[model samples]
Target: MSGEPGARRRRLRELLVDTAPLRQSPAFAKLWTGTSIAQIGAQVTIVAVGLHVYELTHSTFAVSLVALWALGPMILAGFVGGALADVFDRRLVALVTAVAAWLSIGTMTVIAFLGVEATWPYYALAAINAASATIMGATRGAIIPRLLPTQLLPAAAALSGITMGAAITVGPAVAGVLVASVGVPWTYLLDAVLFTGAFLGILSLPRMRPDGERRSAGLGSVLESLRFLKRAPNVRATFVWDLIAMTLGTPRVVFPAAGALVLGGGPVTVGALTAAFAIGSLLSGLFSGPLGGVRRQGRAVTLAIAVFGACTALFGAVLLVTGLTDAPRDADTPLIPAIVLAGLALAGTGAADNVSAVFRTTILQAAAPDDVRGRMQGLFYVVVAGGPRVGDLIAGALATLLALWAPALIGGILILGIMLILLRTARGFQRYDAHAPTP
Candidate 1:
């Protein structure tokens, strides 16, 4: 109600995800476009790195080590990069990390072209690339709120959901074909070149120093951020609720078993289930215009999360029913109806999760102070990185001990119950206002 006339008007057509965010700010437009391309390129390298390492070592465990090596560095970078973002110009921090990632990609390309038989180099480079990317992402996230007015935060977050959805959905498929057709070397080279799009965006940005007190990049600054998160109920809500939802409801661990066991479609069934989630997220972004007008963002996030819980439960139920009333599945014939039903349920979960992401991201950027925002985003990236893995573990444990569908069934119900309770009791979060973000 407080924006410009055009924003206030919000034409009926605009209700279907208009391009107002892109049109309103050229800086944001460039950064968004560039980051979008960079994510696709990054995904390409992520997949290619796995394939390359596997080809060299011929061991899945070795391939797993590549990811494992990246994890430590990425976690460290969150705190360090955040502190750096708070101390130095964010533009500088982002640029440096982007270059580091690009350099690592370029090195991988050269090594691959030279037919390096050693696996250690690839492992080292992959870790560096992942860490640099984490830093870049954290710095970039902190920069978004500065680039756009508060009114446009929801729109920007929605666009980000679209960007991420497309990257994850399209990038892996392209990487598979590219690696198969050309080789790992070319894939690395392509990623290196594509990442220049990120540079273009970073280079275009002006010097962005911390707005308030400057903090040194160290343990104390990081601790300060942790303390801030503890005190800020709204901000804490974003992470706590997200962690609960992910830890309990991640159904991906059962995808393989579900496909081969009850579903009987094998890898194709697994692929379908995975793609359905991304498709749902994409669809939500495509129709995200209405979300921009929501003023009570905390409530919006709560409702979205609650819906996610229901969907997860529904997904589990679909699997449970299929497993119960199913005939002996042939390897050649999949239970098409069950697969469709399960995919739809997962899709619903994806959409609801994305809706929660949109509001939560908006809240983080809108509510958090500018000086330490980078570290906050870094912490967010850590959560983003680790939450799903924990969720997968929960799913795996439940499926191992009980039924393949048990994780979703039990986890979803838990999420629903906890969320409903929180909605009634967490008065501050329930009453949080978008116009005046508390966190």
Candidate 2:
């Protein structure tokens, strides 16, 4: 009986997410701590910005223009910032970009307090903030591989998942409360304060210069990274798979319509759906211990993404059922069964996406040479940021033409089919081994 208890404890330990990366690297620990905190503030600002825009224009389309205005600049900054990270001191680049982002937030706070009602200022400031953030993200992602041993890359990725989960989950909730109670200015001011934590973390890192020949930060360097990607089939496959997943499986664009027309919970339902997805992601990160031990990373990524598609499809089915059943559409009427089903399905998607992210990130860091890691990470950021925007467009257009659930259902099926084809044809990606990490 005593031996059985010991075995049970061992099993539990194996199931929990590994924390060795945090304990072993002081710099990483500090960086992770600061990023996690700052990300929450960032989320608050994101939500607050949207809310403020809506308040000014009383139009959802105008509010969405905020993201539209920021997207192009953010994507451009990602590539440029990534090239710069390879040429300059990565730590310095991150620090400077962090300060730029903080200033943008400060500007927003000032605008709010001064009662600046002009929409153009909000658009301009948001664009600056988004571009700065893209640069900082690209630089920081490249810095992680330097901070830890190659073997611990998966753990670092898992930790990042936890950070994202926490930030998305806590930040929006707090933002909603603050915006309702104190106001948008207070929310922006709080983000400005939290921004200091990120600045300190970057400041604490030692200077990190490129380990190989430096590339100039321009179109040529970006083109060079693309040429390298052409030869790196496995790394390229990671990007392709993620783009497929995000562009097809993402369903956030349908949430507002789902809540109002189908799910019958209005804003409360939308919040619950979003929270459920984040909660699942957080739980997956918490229990990601066995992920680091997985040797067939390519297979892991494929399987996880397949699961993601399946879950998204299930969510769509729930929506379809709710719409067909003539479920109550009023905000006051709760379609409990459909709502529960949709939430669970979305949660499953969150878990699957997090698992896929850990492997995809680990593969990128492990396979890419240090010389072009920043550039590769930069391209990764572009895909990460751009895919969702494209997905939003696809989902919105499809949902408008067919039904609220049509995009998710059709897109999920498309993701699964495409992934299968890729798996069958892309033997290089399928055979990729974490232990060897060949690109």
Candidate 3:
């Protein structure tokens, strides 16, 4: 058809080489390990902060406000951080931002130890942490391509998912135990310690200048990304699809309330549910070798998202059934079956979402021009980071007004339906080739 398919496949193998050891590259391996360890700590703080905030306020609405407070700052930081990454050495940018986040966590630890019950300071620190994290997140994505070969991007992405899944799986559970046994202060301190791994990783990385002229970091760079998006239809579409998938399908906003109502109990249920999603994602990454070899990454992304949506719907259905059976709402009653089933569904969703992330990230990294990659990556981070938050708000509203299951079920169906429609109309996305990515 297009050429000798077998030869192309052979070339792809040479580039990707599944059995090739990642450990051979000390820099790549170190970066991966460092980020993974740091991620675990980050998750602990996530759970701990929520618990701390809730304990002080005892209001679900207030807990949701944390998301809102962080949203705008994160978006602004992502855009500026990206431009900064393009201009300065990315490694330095990442390290500085990481230190900022670590210090914020450390500060929180002190506040907790002081027995400060005030919520405003926590909220302020959370916003600062989020902003720093946004910068670090964008810089890291830009860093991966520099560390590994182009062909290995998919494999690297898969491996990243594995680390992320592991972190997610353990972080919240560990946070719960730490908070319960020791206290919130300890959780914050632990995160501060774990944060060292990330710092070490970035510090060890070589200096990385932009591929071209270092663009000035200002409105000029930010405007460039927006202008590029206006012209780059495929990249634009990918963003839209991801935004829809995350905005519609993210079910986490309801987890706390579900624990209190549908799933029964308190933070324990929340941790278990979060762990289930990570477990599923980890399982997928473990089997990601086959996925790395696939072509047509765009279609692959669409299919993965559709599967995610379906599984979310299944999770919702399970919740509905549990509600109908008059499931336990008390902190005392066991909801083993419901929790397990929901976990299964979340796991499936996690796997599918990871697949989508691999393709979407690859497209952005490969297609975008070097000079503009930072800003574009930043905007991409904003959408990627912000979408779930919007979904959280939506989920909260739906859960408050209707049954908890209503959001997942309705959102799932909407994601699937919208994806199908968009894919059908945008034949270009379906026809996208992994070997020859378009900007």
Candidate 4:
């Protein structure tokens, strides 16, 4: 794809106006709607779970344990689930996973309604929910490429970013309100209701099968995808780049501590900080009219990541200055400037991150073979989804070892340094073209 002749580089104005073919595809619209709805519920549950766990134990370690609890099962299930997506009907895989997730939410609702104060049950239910969601995401992501034409892949990715932005924006804010007003039980119940849309979305897709030899539905299939990743230089590079960004820039794990110790705003502050970032992402996607078609997407991803790192570094600098300067950490005192500046920095990070996401997803869908797309998408999801949780664990641990501000400052510097090294080392990824297949 080439730009208009002699066109001056503008302020991503295409992102400001609507363009492209995905909006015309009814099937894509329906899928986007349903996924967005379910995602809202998913985010609500995430906030509720954290609040509930903290309420029970009042331990930051307990909150971090949520990630540790869900990590292994999600990874293992994601791999097998991706294989199932390849071997069986993609619709069936998604539908079944949705059902499992719905049931998990329902079960949690019952537990909360029954007045179970024990934290173990919440952990158990969260692990189950996380596992199902991992599979559902893998299947759903792989299905998008098949539902639309190749040219519309970027549009689909942009739309998907919009859905995520909406979900994150609505879900956490709703979770905050519901948890504050109606309590955790009602939050889970609301999620149960909201999840119905995803069921309808996946239920309507046409039957799909792997375009290759159907292998046994087990570990062997997963290993096959792993081997493929090893050879796919561009795909591998995408994962590496994303891992660097997520691990180095994910500041969310420090939010709760920031709320309690640094900012003196408590849980409400934590939720607001989370929502502010999501709001930025939503705004970016809503204006993403021209993101649909682009060439040299690899460069776009690298640039986005660099911007993300810069914003994150700015955020850390703000926190460090505030902490070492006049900002008070007393329980009754507030750091208004620090809070406002951090929110702005996080918002910028969200927008840059979303842009990278739009390009990275397009590459994943267009470059990989359909027969093994599920596994590749699963790995993609794992990197994108799981990487942050792992980052959360790192941030949480580091925050405990040092100060709430330390993790962000160190993580930001690390992300910038690693991304530069990766960009310099990876040649094929830098040269990747949106129209061609990767090998």
Candidate 5:
């Protein structure tokens, strides 16, 4: 009887997230720690930049254009940087890009300290910072497989989710408080200082050369990656499914309006909604033990995204209910029921999204040939970076034309339907085995 109890305890422990990757790999541990700290600072700057732009222009379009300006440069950097990682030393690429991104943050701090009122400078520097960060992200992703064995990749990805979830959960809230109290210059300066951790992390990594035939960094290399992806059905499915989920289900663009008009907690409600999603992600990563053993990675991605779409749709329903109710319009009015429902729904979205991300990342890292991993990762970065922007546009336009809730409701349904069709048709992806990676 005592042995049975111990067996049950062991089974329970097995169901929780494994931290073995962090425990086993010192290099990965340092990299994960440094990136986690720096990510929080980066989120601070991201929030501060939007607030600063809005204060200067008083035009949401101008603030939106800030992201627009960064998008093109970021996309270009992902491709070029990925190729560079394949052709040159990945550690050098990561280190140099990290330095450049850090310098951009420093420049932003200087501009803020000078109390520059020029919105153009903000836009220009933000573009540079975004481009540099994109390149750094691509390089770092390509280097991860080199740090750990194949069996632990999923665990590493789960750890990454924890880092991301913590950063996102805490960073923006801190930014809001700091920007409100300490002023924007200090907020920018904080990020610049904290970013030094990322530099240290990249510097700690040993030089990593391409494991197989190296591709020259340029348009031709980019084209070659595209050609390879064309034949790699399973890999193609991951990207397509991710793009679908992101484009359709992301609800962030409507958050401010929802807080003010429907939920009535205003800025607090907006922050709560965002934090709820991050909390979900954090918790999912915290208990991701069983996920590492999942062999049908493609099926897992599909199912997780389906759940994401459902949660988003549920969130839309909450908004719709709030709209129909006699909820007070005052910014301070507490729509506690609605707020709780919305938060829960968004939380569900976050959890599902993180699971899907873990599977997609593992599949990519495990399946792609080492020689082409950098290029593929670059394209992956581009998709990941670009999808949310497109989602924002879709949500914004639909919300403007229909209602705040309409975008989520409509988009969620679209995601579900499209994903189902893709899953039904893509037999190879449906049966993909992690142990026998195919791309």
Candidate 6:
């Protein structure tokens, strides 16, 4: 019986995220740690700033504009930023962008501390910070492949899963508490301080210049990357699957309507439903050891996405049942049982999506040529940033035209049908081996 306990502990260790990448490379370890810490602070600022805007203007439109202003610049940065990383030394690029982001944070901090009471300062600075962060993210993505060996790419990506999981889940909650307890000024200051970790990580790295045919950061470079994508079926498959899953299968669009019409509990229900997805991603990252061992990552991604679609459908079905029943749609009283089931389904989707991300990132970093890695990563940032926005429009339109539940139900079905077709037809993607990555 005592031996059995020890055996169970060993199994648990095997199931957790692999730490080999951290143990093997000191440089990679520091970079990952700094990036993780900085991202958490960045998330804190994001949430707190939204609340701050609301407090200042009492306008929800103003708060919406906060995201609206940043989104365009960030997407533009993704297009141009890759060219910068490919041409310049990545460490230098990261350091420069990190400084830009920090300066934006510092400026916001000062404005809030001085009781500026103005809205434009916040809007302009936040947009700058967002764009800077986008560029920094691209540079760092390009840098990671240079730091770690090809075999450990999946493990590195899994650790990134842990980073994102913490940043999105823990950071926003902390931001809310901090803004309520102290103030917006302090929250911005905290982000500024937290951002220094990125500097430490960037400083630890050696200069990393792109290895192959590099071009200046401009339209020509961006166009060349799109050309590369056309030639690389495996890399292209990653983007296609992600776009389909995110665009069609995202679950958040219906949360508000579902809460009011079917699920009940309104705002609290909405928050719980949102957090449940991040929580599932966090848990999966914590127990992702077996994920690091998969060689046929392309096949793994397909299966993970399939599960994602199924989970979305299940969530919709749960809502459909309550919508049909006599569940109180008061938007006040809680429906704990239905909420629990819905949360679980959303959590399943999050877990599956995170797994898909882990392998898709591995393929991107490992298969793409060194010279255009930054460009590829840049395009990756664009897809990640823009896919959800498009998804939002699609989801919103479907919900409006058909029903609140129809978008999720229909989107889930579409993802399943499309994924299966891709699985069978895109034989190259299914056969892609992590051992000898091909782009």
Task: Rank candidates by TM-score, best first.
Answer: 2, 6, 5, 1, 4, 3
What is the C-alpha lDDT profile of model 6 across 1-439, one tens digit per residue? 8799999999999999999999999999999999999999999999988999999999988987898888899899998888899999898999999999999999999989989988888999999999899999988999999889998888899999999998999898889889999988898888999999998889999988889764678898889889999999999999999999999987587898888878889988998998999998988898899997899999999989998998888888888887888867779877889899999998998999999999999999999998888888888888898888788889889888888877778888888888888789888999999998999
Question: What is the C-alpha local distance difference test score of candidate 1?
Answer: 0.89
Q: Runs in model 3 with CA error above 4 Å?
A: 1-21, 257-267, 326-331
Q: What digit string (tens of lDDT, one per residue) describes model 2 on residues 1-439?
A: 8699999999998888889999999999999989988999999999999999999999999999999999999889978988988899999999989999999999999989999998989898999998998889888889999999989999999999999999999999999999999999999999999988897679879999988975678899999989999999989989999999998887899998888888888999999999999999999999999999999899889989988898889998998878888556887786998899999999999999999999999999889888888888888888998999999888989998988898889888888787777778877788898889998
Q: Of models 1 and 2, which has the larger TM-score? A: 2
Best by lDDT: 2
Q: What's the true lDDT of residue 349 in model 5?
A: 93
Question: What lDDT would candidate 6 get against the real structure?
Answer: 0.90
Question: Tens-digit lDDT track for model 3 on 65-175?
Answer: 777788899999989999998898989999999989998999999999999998989988999998998899888888877877667788887888888889888898899
Task: Mark the regions of model 2 whose C-alpha exceeds 4 Å error after superposition.
Answer: none
Best by TM-score: 2
Model 5: residues with Cα > 4 Å off, grouped in runs: 1-12
TM-score of each: 0.94, 0.98, 0.90, 0.91, 0.96, 0.97
Q: Could you give the C-alpha RMSD of every candidate to the true structure, in order shown? A: 3.6, 1.1, 5.0, 3.9, 1.6, 1.5
- Provide the overall lDDT of each model, using Cα atoms, as 2-decimal numbers: 0.89, 0.91, 0.84, 0.82, 0.89, 0.90
**How many clashes in candidate 6?**
0
* Arranged by lDDT, best first: 2, 6, 5, 1, 3, 4
The clash numbers for all candidates, in the given order, read: 1, 0, 0, 1, 3, 0
TM-score of 1: 0.94
Model 1 residue pairs with clashes: 367-439
lDDT of 1 at 396: 85
Where does model 6 exceed 4 Å of error?
Answer: 1-6
